[model samples]
Target chain A: MSNQEILNKLRDTIVTQDIKGCEAAAKEALEADISAFDAINGGLAVGMKIIGDKYELGELYLPHIMMSAKAMDGAMGILTPELEKDKTTESIGTAITFVQQGDIHEIGHRLVSIMLSVNGFNIVDLGVDVPDETIIDEIKKLNGSKVLLAGSALMTTSMQGQKDTMEAIEKEGLRDSVKIMFGGAPISQKWIEEIGADATAKNAADAARIVLKLMD
Target chain B: MTNRMTPPERMMAVMTGQKPDRVPVVPFVLGYASKVTGISLGDFYADGDKCFEAQFASMRLHGYEQTPMYGYASMGAFEFGGEIEYPYGKGQGAPFVKKHPVETIEDIEKLEVPDFKKELPGAYKQADRLASRCSELGLPVSVQVGSTFTAASVIANTSEFVSWLIMEPKAAHSLLDKVCNMFINAIDYFAEKYGAENMLPFDGGPSESNTMISADMFAEFAYPYMKRIHTHLKELGVNSVLMHPCSDQNKNIPHYIKLRNEIGWSGKYVWLFGPETPVKTQVEAFGDHDIVCGNINPSLFITEPYEELLEICGQNILEGMNSPSGFILAAGCEFPPNAAPIKLMAMLDAAEKYGRYE
Candidate 1:
């Protein structure tokens, strides 16, 4: 098969959410002498973009996105090591994602993290029920580098944790270097403005675009 | 002008599709009541008397039409012999499931519906006391039979439950059936105690929202169980039902309407929707047969200034007042516990100013 054809197979695996197929395609790309970077950017990332657009258009739902993300992760598992050997991996920017303290609903947070990762962002995933102090400590570790610190909450009670995390960032003098975004069922653009956060997105796909713009 | 109807009378008028003196304002106020009464939500959920007292006081303070009712989102876990944590800390909202009973497929086989009378949790005990108090005061006894799907989900981890709907349909069905049986048992208990004719059942649909699952998935997993529970409610001679479809459920409306029609459960469906579905859309869908209530964004209470809150509440009242069956202004979902009290008052004030009948 032609190298381009092999790359197309990689893309199809993600769009179709064929997890095993994605792993096989990654191997085929490796054998066909396709560069890992090209296999990712030219194939897997393109497929992710398709699924992301479909999700944004409401043609795809959570399970589809989740399966597609799993497919992408499988392909990345095969290609990441190869890319690392080349020492030429490039990322868009770093994003620190978490579900706010006292909330365990991480579906939205996981979706955003998956979208950002597939869009080439280095993700620091702080899992659910993360406190403000822990979030600030992660921000401190980012050390003045431009980062997108995103948090989500499923309940109104936990939603305040987002505000507290953002406030803690400001109190620790890390506000200027970081972009703060909040998303969840209860969050709104008006709430973001009220809480003095940087941005809010309608959904995970939109979150990727907003993070990209904020990074730029 | 002095009001011609008391809160109960106004609510009853709307429930029966008779013209009320004004539109009813029934905000889903739960923990917010505790916040108003200056009690720790931990204490509030633990003590039925306090929970009812706080809710009643908040109702009187706001002068809204609905009285205090006992129920929380994290319901099934505690009732099913799992653990739950109440909103005790600052900014803590409502009670949440601390542990799930049926964590695995094998656990589902071992699961038994607890005798609610024997294994009553804090909330259930409190609900019992609340109902007793209502009965003592000659008020209608209110009980919860909501989102059998949500209760089932709480019994397991939510994500696991959603995944089971797709991956393990049999297990999902088994769990849902068990939950329905549990609900039926609870309904029987409540009905036998309070007399079904004098009871009102509160239902909420948070897990079934389109944002969480596809409408097709909802139809498959949530619909049948909801039908079963409502059918039981109907069988028990319960006439009035208040259902809150808590979030964006435009896609799920047809299924809900179908359930209502199939079961022939009509009248005051406080079918309050979340802000994701507009009031106009809800009225257009449910206005003819059910008392359409709510669509006011709950976030507005915390984020928006008083003027904005008033304007939003007023807009919803305008859209909902002319509902053929009836209309009751309400927050889209549970009123935020941390929201400014004045914002809730804005809803009542809006109902009075803009919701009056000619």
Candidate 2:
């Protein structure tokens, strides 16, 4: 197949959420002399980009997003090793991310984690129900002089976990070294200020802009 | 004058575009009440009497005007042959998906509209028992039925639901049609049990905001099904429907207001929880034709100090105060189940102190 054909095939296969189809098409791309980077950027990435846009447009739904994300992951499983051989980009910085301790709703923060990593940032996704101490400990272990700490809490009650994490950052005397940001159903600029968070984000796209600006 | 209106009268006043005796205190508190009543999360969901008692105790204990219906996410969803896994172990958060019943698009075609008495016996009992108790006390019976999309989302999982919208639009409509049928039946049941006049027909779910879908998507999926429910009731002469969408669903506010217009909600009778929509935009869209509640950040109840909580509440009231239809002070969404007692008390108390109209 031609270069354009392989890329089109890759996009179509992933959109169907056929795992085997993705693997085969992705393999076919590599066999067709399409660079692994081109296969990902042109094919798999294009599928997810459409999914993300459609989701924002409300043309699509959350299940489609999960499926698209899954498809992207599946394609990467077959292509990452090949792309890694000639990769040359360095991560921008480390972002310490977690859903605040006791908050079960996690898709909000997990998406931000994926965006940051995809944008070439070293992402430490601490996962859900993570406590403050563990956050501080992760930042410490990173051995970085500066880091970004992100917390997400969907429940009004669990938002306290964001504040607690902030307090822990201060209690451990790491206040000056960290930038804390939060997002969730309940989070707002007013609440962010009241809780002493450095910033608040609406979604992964907004988060990337905020994180990049904060880094600068 | 606002402070002197009776609780029900005050609520009624706001619903009619009249000045309330004061700002109405209407917080959704089932989750909070369950923890306070010391019921295990599992037991709390499983038992109807306990659910009713918890809500009754919360009203008695907290003293808010709104009667929060203690409904679990799974209460109605599980009635359709799905498993529900509530957080039972130590420090577990909220209940979550163990398995989605509609694993394939074909499953959507196979399922039937759930019968409340047979399919959702426990939820039906809770509703029946609570409606009776509230009726005895002359309280308007309320049931917080999530939107059909939310019901369908749980039955099939959000991932499957969204993908179905893309890969299988036919199945998506089929599932939504089934869920909507169940809702229409449940609505008729409650309307008969309690007077439909007193019923709010709260069609709540994730679609209330753009966090789930764009306005066009909501217009395609949620608007049609939700409008059907409201229209069916309106044909029976019920004119109002209250929709609760969460987060900063500002983008969809105009669309929702438009949908509410179609749903036959008018004046202060139909209220939309204004999260991020500008006050001017709200007045511009519906004028004095609708009621607006909240945009208050719910997290303050959990994490903010009293003074900040009061400040945010005051700001929300002031913003909504300028609306032509009217404003009611409520958490932008449901109060955090673990919200501080003081904050919950302060919600009503702040209205008394700051939301008074001469």
Candidate 3:
């Protein structure tokens, strides 16, 4: 098969959520001498963008996205080693994602991480119920690098954690370097503005778009 | 100015499909009660008397027409023998599942309907106290009959349970069935204790929303079991039901309407919708038969200016005022626990200013 045909197979595996088929397709792409970078950009990332768009259109749901993520992971497992060997696997930038402190509702956080990672952003998922200090510490470690910090809170009580993290970030002198994006059931553009956040996403796809724009 | 009917009388008028003096404003205030009333969060949840008193105090202080109630969103974990962390620290809300009971698929078989008398003595005792207090005050007794799918998520890891919907259908159904039965049992206990006729079952399905699951998934994983529970509620002679289909659930609205129609719960049924579903849509859908309670954006209470809140509430009231059943202005979900008091007052003021019936 031609290289384009092999790449199409790789993309098909992700869209269909064929987990085992993804690994086979990734290997086929490699065997056909398709560059891992091309296979991902031409194949997997294209498929993920489709998934993201479908999700935004409400044609897909969380479980489907998750399944697609698994398929992406399956393909990435086979392709990452090759991509790293070619020294072309560098990420666009780093993103820190977490559910606010005292809030463990993390489906939103996971979705953001999945969208960002597949879109070539390195994701540092601090997991759920992450403390404000821990988030600030992660931001501090990134130092002078431009970082996208996405925090979410599912409850009204936990929403204050985002504000606390913002204050902590500014105090550490990392405010200018970090662009904070907050989203959740209780978060709105008004809340984001009130808290001085850089952006607020309506959904995971919107989150990727917001992060991409901010990064650019 | 004095109203023709008292708050309770106004609520009853609306519940029974008669136009009230004005639309009742019932914000879904929970832990916010503890915070605003100076009660410790731990005491508010763990102590039923304090919980009841604090909620009452908050209502009276705020001067809203809502009755003080007791229940939490994360209802299954503690009842199922999993540990839960109460919101005692800053930026915390309701009790969350600290440890899920079913860690492995093997644990599914071990799951059983816990005896509220034994396994959850604390919760049972607290609920009993709450019911008794409500009965003493002639208020509707609160029953925690929230969504089984949500509880099932709490019974296991949420992501794991969600994946089980696709990867392990049988396991997901098994867990869902168990939680559904568990909720039914809890309702039965409350019914037997408080008398089902006097009890009001408050159910919110946040995990079942389109944000997490699709309408197709809801039909498969949530609808059948929810139907069973609502059918059981109908059999129990419970007339009043309040359901909050939380967040972006326009797709699932049909299933909910179907469930209500199937059970013939056309009267005294309240749908408190998230802002995602406009109040106009809710009234258009269910207004002919049942009370449509809300569609206010709860987040607006904290962030939006007071005038903006008034406009939103005013628009909702205008859309819902003409429903055949009735309408009550309420927050789409639980009013944010830390939302401003003035914003809540704005909600009530909007109802008073525009909710008056001719």
Candidate 4:
């Protein structure tokens, strides 16, 4: 099959939430001797990007996104070993992401983490309710490598924690070492300025684009 | 004419589709009440007396048209044997489901309906006392109950609930049925004290927002349950319901208006933050029972310089007030606890300035 055909098949499997179809597509790409990089970039990444786009457009929901994410992750697993020989361990920029302390609702941040991973950024997901110290610890533990410290606040009540995290980074002497970004229902461009965040994202796709630009 | 009407009278006038002396400003004032009352939020919640005082103080401070039955945006899962982390003190964000009670289909199968009034003792006592207090003072009261979908999110935890919707949808429905029963039981308890038509808030889960879910998924998972509850309340004679589905509900706005009409919620019912639904669009689509609640950005309420913010907010007032649909000035979502008092005043101030009919 042509690469476009294989990519289209893979994307359909994800959008349709056909997990078995995703595995079969990965196997078909292998038989065609498609490079692992293209298989992932052109196949898995393309599928996830569509999922993200549809999600933003409100054409999709959590179940579809969740089911598709699982499918895409499975296909990536099948292709990663094949790419291991040619791909360097140092893939690209690193991002440290979490739900700021006291804000536990994190599906948005989780999607952003998944999208960032698919787009080849190293994601250090600290899960929900992460303290500034943990974020600082993750950055310093990276041994002077630049990283993106991303946080999200689902509640307006906890939005102050985003600013607190930023202040904590500055106090911990890692202010210049990392760029902070936030996203959620409560954040706006005005509030983003009030809080002093480096950037704000509407969704995972937007987050990926911004993270890529920040890295550049 | 504007200053002659008391807060409750002004609010009542609008609910019945009459011109109040002025536009009624009804921002959601829950945790923020504690801040103005000089009580810790935990005390306000944990102690019913303090909660009552805080609510009243919040009304006096904000010049809100209703007595505060204001409460945490929770589904009361903790009272129903779910693990919830109640925010214990000041600056603690709202409580949330700490651990989901249902992890498997078996867990869902074993669920039993808890006694609503007995389960949430503090909330009931507070609501009962607050209602009586408001009654004596001739004030209006507004309180919120989470919808079955939101309660299910709290009871099952959101991540697991989504999995159930996909994998074990039958169990998901069963759990939602159980939570709906809990809500009904609570409503039944409150309906006796508060009038049949006076329930203030019934939240449709934000997870069911069009931005968060597909129409198909919402139709299957959320719509039926919400319709069932709305129909249930209608049967009980409780008519006025505030359905706050936060964050950009433009995708589901038509369905919202349709659902309310279909279920015969003919009294004052609002779909707040069908966010960014144009005022003109809302009036045209909402038809006869059309009432525009709010679409103002809640984030704007926290920033500085009340005057400039009032100018921006004034546009929303002018448009909503000009619409044939009856209007109430409110934030798209809850008034942030940290939102400066002055900024909140600006919302009401704008309402009075630009919302005047005379």
Give the least accurate 10-residue stretch of model 1 chain B, judged by summed lDDT: B114-123
lDDT of model 4 at residue A177?
77
Off by over 4 Å in 3: A29-36, A81-89, B1-3, B117-124
Every model's TM-score: 0.94, 0.81, 0.95, 0.90
lDDT digits (tens) for residues A104-203 of candidate 1:
7767888899888778888999998787888888888988676888888877888877777767777888888888899988898878987899998988
Docking quality band of candidate 4, CAPRI definitions: medium
C-alpha lDDT of all candidate models, in order: 0.83, 0.70, 0.84, 0.74
Put the candidates in lDDT order, highest first.
3, 1, 4, 2
Q: What value does the lDDT take at residue B334 in candidate 2?
A: 66
Per-residue lDDT tens digits of candidate 1, residues B147-263?
888899889977667667756899999988888888888888889998998888888868887777788988888888888888888888888888888788889998987887898
Write down the worst ten-residue block by lDDT for model 2 chain B.
Answer: B265-274
lDDT of 2 by residue, B1-358 (tens): 3247777787777777688767777776666677778887656555656767787788778666776464544344565766666655433444555566788887877787767655444356656677777777877667655577777877776656776776777888898888888888887778876777767667676533567666666777777887787777776555456667655566666666676567655423445554565555665666557776755656667667888777777777776666777776776666777677888877777787778886
**Per-residue lDDT for B139-207 in model 3, tens only?**
998777878888788889887788778888999998888888888888888888788889888887688
Ranking by DockQ: 3, 4, 1, 2
**Of the candidates shown, which would achieve the greatest lDDT relative to the real structure?**
3
Candidate achieving the largest DockQ: 3
Candidates 1 and 2: which is better by DockQ?
1
TM-score of chain B of 2: 0.89
Off by over 4 Å in 4: A1-12, A23-39, A75-89, B89-92, B117-143, B193-198
DockQ of 1: 0.50
lDDT per residue as tens, model 3, A118-164: 78887899998898788878987997776888888888878977888
